[model samples]
Target: MGKAKKFRGLKFKYKVDGINKQLTDKYQTIEEFLEAEFPKNNNPLSPTGDTKIYDVTWNTHKVSINKIVNTLSDLRKVLSVDCYVTNTDIRLEKIKPRELERKSTYSIEQIRELTKEVLFEEDKRNAKVELDGDIIKGNSQRYQTFFTKGIKCVCCGIEGKYFAKEKVYRDKSYHLNLYAVDENGKEVLMTKDHILPKSKGGQDHIDNYQTMCVNCNVAKGNNLED
Candidate 1:
């Protein structure tokens, strides 16, 4: 028996005349495979509709909606295909780019002030610390250390700057942005990463934390350094 075919982590196996064949070889691209497996007519609801549900399947195997969406999203990053999942229906369309607006940069002091006003309550509830061997509610000591040492990506060594933008929705709220400037002076979002990922049994304590740029963190995923 031949090995099963894998597509974006999903396995597809097929048998023909008592012989197993790779199903992935039949399709030229992910877009082709998607169109062939999930035809447009299978979706009765309009593309614009809020609720459009379909039983996603490939041959006799039932595929989860999340798997399909994740596959499509992964493909979009590599391929030129622009698409969005509305429920189970994958709608292929040219996404209009939003206009770029010049965002105001804030000093570390200003950022501290804004964070206190916007996210202080939420952070206070979520953040915890161990005081004299007793776990207590407080801001993360690691975060405090990072702030004091200046926020910077440990991997790339890019210093992070803070910004806050007002939300446009009815209930207006502030959106805090933590961005790092690259060599080319381009701004990239900064993130807090686990030195040893939480999935690998790493604790959410001060010692296990590090600052990372979004791209580096995504590339790292759940991987541990050798």
Candidate 2:
């Protein structure tokens, strides 16, 4: 080798002094600290509880709770608790980057079958449909299939996850509705868009239907696509 490569760029080095003291002083062992921090009832990390930590150091450090847990777990893998506690100059480094989006590994045929199953179920329940002149609307089940299978958006190409049996308050009553959770953790209502809008004399047919997120569909409005 001619020369050793020098690392260059905005390097992020986190000082563990404050966090180490906070963790070490609170509990004698790491196991004790973890147990107290992640309790079953009223836990911050739980779905119902507040996920965010209001610590000044943690906020400034720009590290997630999951990252901290993973770092400690990794340390426990090789070094003993005493060794890790004594090693005050411990550094967290990214050995491998994680994928941004969790995609479904389902095949094309599998997706088709899943979609068909949803449609069949909707038909069995006699799903309500709204008739507007010659245009029959409200085939929500068709679009719900995309959410059920975690399909990507046609416009933004963002993947969505099905959040089943969400209670919706409508007309002074609660009704369960199908919703999809997007990459940003936002709840998205899936909709079936007509390729050719009904306003432009588009027929209400299966061939003309396409799945779209509520946001994208609202943005598209009555604008015809080429």
Candidate 3:
């Protein structure tokens, strides 16, 4: 729920751009005018009517005067009166528990509590697992690979720094790794191939996996019968 604001204890300073006898006669000072227009306790102004004098015109060159000062000037300007006034300090009224009335709907707290109860009831339907806050050990296939075991490809003596994909396999089901040295003497990758066709119900499991250079894999792809 959004909070409603009540302003109080505002201190204002005012100056007129030009003299106007009609406004001057009604209120001699800006403070007096504000006090009369917004009486204590009756309006948003504080009952104490605290005020102080201070100079705020330090940087007139950089930016225009504060909005509060300009707004006061504009209000009087509309009535052919030119004035510069600013409220220095304003206190926000403390928020109290309030109920908005429409003569139909529930209060804010009632809606909030009901929403929380519904969410909790929905959460109870989810599966619950016992967590002792300790890391549990499990055998993941990712950890059993040559990449994890620090083993080089069976066909290539050196493990390449990159892995190349064989496109002739009809789909990118797996990657084959071969090794070669570039002119810079850096280990380069070759394509890995499945000894049996995966489309022919061949397993990508460990025992069936084989590494082949790109050239060999492409040659095999052309020679193998459909």
- What ordering of candidates by TM-score runs from best to worst? 1, 2, 3
Give the candidate number with the greatest lDDT: 1
lDDT of each: 0.44, 0.39, 0.32
**Model 1 misplaced regions, further than 4 Å:** 1-104, 116-149, 166-172, 222-226
Better-scoring candidate (TM-score), 1 or 2: 1
* Error in Å for residue 164 of model 1: 3.7
Question: Candidate 1: lDDT of 159?
Answer: 76
Error of 1 at 197 (Å): 0.6
Q: Against the hidden reference, what TM-scores do the models get?
A: 0.42, 0.34, 0.22
Across 152-203, the per-residue lDDT of candidate 1 in tens digits comes to: 8888788777643322232122234467777788878666677877656776
* Per-structure clash totals for the candidates: 0, 0, 4
Candidate with the larger lDDT of 2 and 3? 2
Which residue runs does candidate 3 get wrong by more than 4 Å?
A: 1-145, 148-158, 162-187, 222-226
Error of 2 at 151 (Å): 2.5
List, residue by residue over 136-181, the lDDT tens digit for candidate 3: 1112122123333333444544444432222222222222232455
